[model samples]
Every structure is written in structure tokens, then in C-alpha cells.
Target: MVTTQERVGAEPDFALNPSGQFGVYVHVPFCASRCGYCDFNTYTPGELGGATPAGWLEALRSELALASQRLPGPTVDTVFVGGGTPSMLGGDGLAEVLDAVRSEFTLAPDAEVTTEANPESTSPGFFTRLRTAGYTRVSLGMQSVAPTVLRLLDRVHSPGRALDAAREAQDAGFEHVNLDLIYGSPGESDDDLHRSVDAAIGAGVDHLSAYALVVEDGTALARRVRRGEVAAPDEDVLARRYELLDTWLADAGFTWYEVSNWSKPGGECRHNLGYWNGGQWWGAGPGAHGFVGATRWWNVKHPNTYAALAEKRELPIADFEVLAPRDRHVEDVLLQIRLRSGLPTSLLDADEQARAESAVAAGLLVHDGHNLVLTDRGRLLADGVVRDLLAD
Candidate 1:
């Protein structure tokens, strides 16, 4: 496990091409409430005590100002505001966040700016302002459309809210809309997932991200499963659900671009593509992570500490490591293989290339003369395939 240490002072590497495609990821750690299945670094107003939204925004601005000076570059090609509930900051607050980013970096001619918003937290005014503020995309956390599934996941939105939010965003002039779905919740049925998919398609979203629910340790859901309050979905059942989701999404005119992401042609989330394709980015806010070249680092997890660092005009970087060549290669395989363009064979060595060939023979991949693309089955067993490809 990569562990964090105290921030070791160093200048951000400005050796990057000034005109390169750079991304900015700003984290908003505030949420209305904690969901049972969530373990992300997020806090509610009650839990946050005196750490008001205004203070957090102030600290974020300080970090952005500092980062802009440290890493001089052309306008950011993409920016993603995620976590807690970004919409809870309200449209004006979100606009302010973007404005701070603008003060430091210029936005590219077609910069893909995205924000992840919860369904219940948005309105017409909110969407209208977001578009006016220059946001190009909105990814709403729809989770599931079934009330039972929503309750099981501890999601607060009503069954129709996500669809309603999607329509509202479109009405507000956002053609680039994405709905995030979570399948395999303990009580989620095939029919429930069907409704969810149908509703997402009906919403006319251009992008969809359907993920399998994994009960991570320490989450409230994990505890429920541990105490037998809820049964975990059987592996075979989850597999079938995944197949159903893929079929439904494909029939709805969406193409699988990643393991859990689908999109219409030209509707892919460019900000995410930046991350998967190894582009440089600076992560702002508490518990955010950033990367430049082979060096990756994370900020302090606590909002108070993060605020203190920023107020002191510090980078707020907690720890960083220059990835070893092997580490970088393993990560490339891990991320690139899951992408639709597939992993380039040129990234592998003679031994790994042989392994790739062996994987092809095993029906886990198809070498299309240039790139090694995952077959349908390979995507389902991607973890094992990654391990095999990385094997010594």
C-alpha cells in the first residue's frame, strides 16, 4: 500500500510542455449526509462543525493560486469538480471555484469542464448558472431507479429525481450529460436494473457509467453485511447483472468505452480520459491527489489541516513519490487495458509480449495487429488478466 507522509517541500516540476493538455481536479469534501456504502473523504455540515463552506472555498482558492505559480502551463484542457456533493456548494459557489482556477490557468478553446452533482441537489437555476459559468458537462449520481435499491444503497434521491435532473440539465443547455449507475446492490433485482437503464436512456443522456457495488471495509454497508442485516449479492448474480447492463446500454445506442463506462460517439468524458491516458493534473482540496510526470502525491485528509497549509501559502501536498519504472508500467497496463482503444503492445517487453500472446490464445484478448484489445470475457476478468500480464 502506498502510504502518505508529511509534505516534503519541493517545487512543482514545470518542465512540462507549456502547451500540453493539462487537467485540474478540485475536490469538494462537503456532503449533506454520509451514505451507508460511501467511504470517500467527505463530511456533512454537522460533522464538519465550524469548517464552513466559505472557509473551504477560501482555502481552495489559495491552493489554486499556489499551484498556478508552481506549474506554469497553458490553459487547462480539462477540469473536474467531484466529491461530497459538489452541487451542495450551490451554483454560485461552484462558479467561484471555476473562477479561482481561471485566475491561475487559462481554459483551452474547447476545455472540457465537468462537475459531479447529486440529483436531489440541483434545480433549473443551478443548471442554468453552471452552463453560464462555462461548465460543459454534468455527471449526476443516479445510482439506481428502484426505491428498494436506493434505500439499500443509502442514497437520498427519489426514484425520479435523477431523470428529472438530467432533463433539467439538458433544458439548461448542457448536451453533455452523464448518469452514473450502480448495479448489484444487495436487494437490486434484474427488473430493477432494467428500469434504471431504461430510465437513463429515456433521460437522453449521452454518457453512462454503470458500476458494480463493492462493499468496502469500514463502510456502514459492510457492517450490515458482516452482521447479516443484508445479504451480499452472489457472484453469479452480479455477473448476470453486468451482462444485462451491457446489453441494455448497447441496445440504447451507447457504446462501451471503458469497463464500466458507456457513451455515444463523441460524448466521452474528456476530463476522465485525461486521467486514464496519463495526462498531467493538479488536485485541489482536502484529500485530493495530483500527478506530474512520474511523481504522484496526495494532500492532507483533514479539511482543517488542509486549510492551515493553504493559508500559510504552502502547497498542501502531504506526500509524494516518483514512480519506479516497474510501478509505472504496471499502472499503464492496469489502466490502459481497460480503455476502449486498448493497450499498445509497444508498452510491453518480449516476455510480457509473450504473455499477451498467451492471453490471446486463452480468449482474454485479441491482438488486432497493433493494440491488444480485451474481448468481452476479458473485460469481465480484467483483474486476473492484468495480474497475468504483469507476472514475472
Candidate 2:
């Protein structure tokens, strides 16, 4: 058994879990091109200087080996390969990533292995290769079907590519395929949003995740908004879009498992659920964040730095924070309350329970015996509801 100090030689004390449920998150921070709204730590070929996938794979293997030793006993239940366009690695490259993971950590009998793919970069052959390589799920970014919206977001795929990719994944034996949609882009209209969702539903994917376009600072969208070249998504418009999405998805037999995600039965993304439902997981690769026990840590944002640290046989942890009791309670109320299972009211203090009562009376929440669940109206204000529950 490797001691905690053995996890990251130069870093502060880490690796807080020895047993229990855990997952693995692998980040591939390489994209074909930068998306306007993306602020994630990704580098295109031009930005990479001289970094190569071969070099990155070695670093990833090193990290996973350390993680396996650091958190022994319990096997990983899920593996999520997220990206800077993971599909950019092609089928063989992604297969190498999973091979590295398997060689290091022991996985559960039915581990759900998933990878996020870009529509333009994926194909029937790509999906089939992934299935053959043991990937059980595929998530493709299908932000919008509108050409103008795609251009505005700097997406490279054509309007029909996402729909094509989704169908190919299903045909390639992916039962848990997910398509992501982004609503409320400045140039997008209601018809565009409707058409996009309808097309996604028609594509036979089992899961859909829709999010309002957010203009984060340092992103191209933020710069455009600051220059008055584009308008920020209106709050009222976003709410209306959310309502429309819920109604449409519900009518199509999909259920909202979380505020931003909907899916057919048993089609939910388990790796994401791990993040929301207080499960421990190791996050490898550049800019990935991980949580195990009460402690959370993130890797260095630059891929080069991450790889260099791995070269020294060290975990590329940039910083870590051990959550306090109050912090844990606040996070629990904030996250679990948004889920379908709801938060146990027993976890709330007297003041929070009283606040929950007020929310229930206001129809923002409902009491399912011991749990406090968000009503449809409440999900529209999920953040507010969580705040009210935690308010002093």
C-alpha cells in the first residue's frame, strides 16, 4: 500500500481515500480550434508549441499509476474522458487512453466508460472502434443546429453533423449516447432551439444536456459582449428557453434528472452524477479537478507543466483544500437538492429546515416525507432555492 506522501512527492499531503466508491476523470486539453465561449484550459496545435499526444499519454499513465497506488482496494466505478475535443485524438488515440487507465486502476465489473466527442470529428467508424475498445457511452457536443449560432460559437461542424454522429453512435452499439445542446446564444432564435432539440430527440440518443450560453470572462464571447458586438443571454429569455426545453423533453418521454440534463430511463451520465452526488474520483490531465474524502484538488492548468511534473514522477496537483464541516453541509444542500432523489431534510439545521418550510409553502419545493425536492417551478430558480435553504 502506497502512503499518502507517496502520491505526490513534492506536493502537500494528499490522497484521502483508501476504500469506497470512486471514479476517474481524464482530461485531454487539445482542441482542433478554440470555441468562442470556451474558457477551459485547452490548447490548439498552434498554441502547443511542440507538445505531442505521445508525450501526453506517457504523463497520463504516470498519473493514473500514482492514483491507483494512492487509493487502493475499491475499484473505480466509472471513467469519463472529457476534452478539448477528445475525438481529436481519433479512435486509436482514445483507445490508448482507456488502455492506460485499465493498466493502472482496477475497475468495477460494470464500469461505465465514456468519452466526449466532437460531431465533426466522429463517424460510424469512430463509434464502432470506440465500442470495440470497450467504451460504453459517448457524449457529443451538439450545441445548436443553426449555422449562424454555430459560427458565433466557433463550432466547426455543419448543422446535420451532430444528428448524424448521434445516430452512428447508436448504430455502433452505444446505448448510453448523450448529445449536449446550448440555448440562448445571441444569434439563436426560439425556432433554432426547438429544431435543435427536436433533431437531437429524433437522432435516437438516450441522453441530452442543455445549458444556457454563459459568457465567461477571458472567453471570446465575453470580449464580444464587452465590445457590444453581441448581446449577453437575457435572464428572462434563458428562463423561457429552460421551460421550453423541459416541456419538449418531457413530452418526448425524457425526464430531467438534473437542472441541465435530461435522459431516457437508465441513460443518465453516471460519471457526472458522481460529481454531484458526493462520490470520490481522481481527475487526471491538465486543469482537471478531483475530490476524494473531504479534500478537493486541481491540477496545473498547462498541459506542459502537468507532463513535466509527471516526468518527475510527481502528481501535478496545483492546489488543494480540505472541506470544513460547514462547507460540506452547504455543498450537500446546494447539490443534492437539485437532484431527483432530493436532499434529506434531516441534514438541514433548524434554521434551514424552517427556510425549507417557507419554500415548500411557496410551492418552490415539496416534501416527500424525509426529502425536500424541487418542484418544476423550483428548478427554474434552483440556485435561489439552494440559497434560501442555506441563508443565515
Q: After superposition, how far is residue 192 of candidate 2 from its true place, in Å?
A: 1.0
Which pairs of residues collide in candidate 2?
none
In candidate 2, what are the lDDT values of residues 58-170, reduced to their tens digit? Answer: 99999988887776456889999998989989999999999999898888889999999999899899999999998999999999999999999999999999999988998
Task: Give lDDT for model 1.
Answer: 0.89
User: All models: lDDT?
Assistant: 0.89, 0.89
Best model number under TM-score? 1
Residue 383 lDDT, candidate 1, scale 0-100:
94
Off by over 4 Å in 2: 1-20
> Whole-model lDDT for model 2 versus the true structure?
0.89
- What are the RMSDs of all candidates, in order? 1.6, 2.9
